[model samples]
Target chain A: SAVISQKPSRDICQRGTSLTIQCQVDSQVTMMFWYRQQPGQSLTLIATANQGSEATYESGFVIDKFPISRPNLTFSTLTVSNMSPEDSSIYLCSVERSINTGELFFGEGSRLTVL
Target chain B: DQQVKQNSPSLSVQEGRISILNCDYTNSMFDYFLWYKKYPAEGPTFLISISSIKDKNEDGRFTVFLNKSAKHLSLHIVPSQPGDSAVYFCAASKERDGNNRLAFGKGNQVVVIP
Candidate 1:
């Protein structure tokens, strides 16, 4: 298991503004994933961040809107640009422990609310 | 398409009883399945997992049963406690791609009453 932390545990932002959420892991991991959980909905993968490579965005998500940075294996950041009410959701960062089982360890999410 | 599905939105069980949470998936390609427990304002924590090769896996009071043929899996918590009350999520992933992307189901909120 890994200890993961996220900054801005909860935030209120104005529409059209941008907010960046930072994720830090205790141990270096190969693949890091970003997900969004809307109220009462299942999580949706936003992107996959790998060190020293471009972040892979999932369908319906674009890098222009949610730019991700993975400068190192232990750290990654997700920025929500030009925020809207729809962008208000819990953003989570996770890393897979084993490829064989696909078990994941997640960070306490950054909850964003756009006004 | 929703690859993973948890039909129950909420479940209430008495302490010391069995708490059964069911999940169904439409994708047969998934080889690994996991169950996660989440608390409000916190991230989900991995509870247990089962592989396609195994029918059941148990850890302490938690057990996971996988039925590959039916595309269904379930988590059984024996002697459920109030501390077990939380939202439980089921996730599935295929291992061939090495992508490790998990398809999650709508979580089930479990309330264990004393």
Candidate 2:
């Protein structure tokens, strides 16, 4: 497990607004991921934050809706654009704990409530 | 479509008793199975994992059992403690797929009472 920190642990946003969540890791890592868990739902992978390149999004997620930026290996950000009530969920940042096993260490998630 | 299924949404156990969580997967491509635990207002944390080549892996009080033929897996926690109460998630993936993407299932909330 790595020392990971996220900003805006909890927030309430209005519909049609946008919010950006920041994830900071203690050490430089090659792979950083973003995951979202909706109410009563499982965690879904939003994208993989690749350093020095555009993030790779999952099938159901689009880069326009969820823009990601990885300026450096130790820092990354996920922006939820044009949010709606249905977009309320807990977003998390995780780093690969072990590449061989694909184990991840997650930070406390950022909980969003869109009204 | 949900590839992984955890039938029971919740489980309750007494202290010092055993807590069992079951998980089933429909995708045969998933060869690596993992269990994660989450507390309220926190992200899910890695617990234990088993490879397709192995049937069982034990770590301290937590043990994971895998039955590849049946596409079923289980997590057993012996001598359950109150601190063990949390939501446990079942996740599967193909390690060598190059991408570390994982499919997660609805977590099971386990309450340990003394």
Clashes of each: 0, 0
- Per-residue lDDT for A1-115 in model 2, tens only? 5899999999999999999999999999998999999999888999999999899998999999999999999999999999999999999999988884657899999999999
Highest TM-score, which number?
Answer: 2
| DockQ (CA atoms), all models | 0.69, 0.67
- Poorest 10 consecutive residues of model 1 chain B by lDDT? B93-102
Q: Per-residue error at B77 for model 1, in Å?
A: 0.4
Tens-place lDDT per residue, model 1, B36-101, is 999988999989988899999999999999999999999999989999999999999888855367
Per-residue lDDT tens digits of candidate 1, residues A45-69? 9999999999999899999999999
Error of 1 at A92 (Å): 0.3
The best candidate by DockQ is 1
Write the residue-wise lDDT of candidate 2 on B36-85 in tens digits: 99998787889999999999999999999999999999999998999999
- In candidate 1, stretches whose alpha carbon ends up further than 4 angstroms from where it belongs are none
User: Clashing residue pairs in candidate 1, if any?
Assistant: none
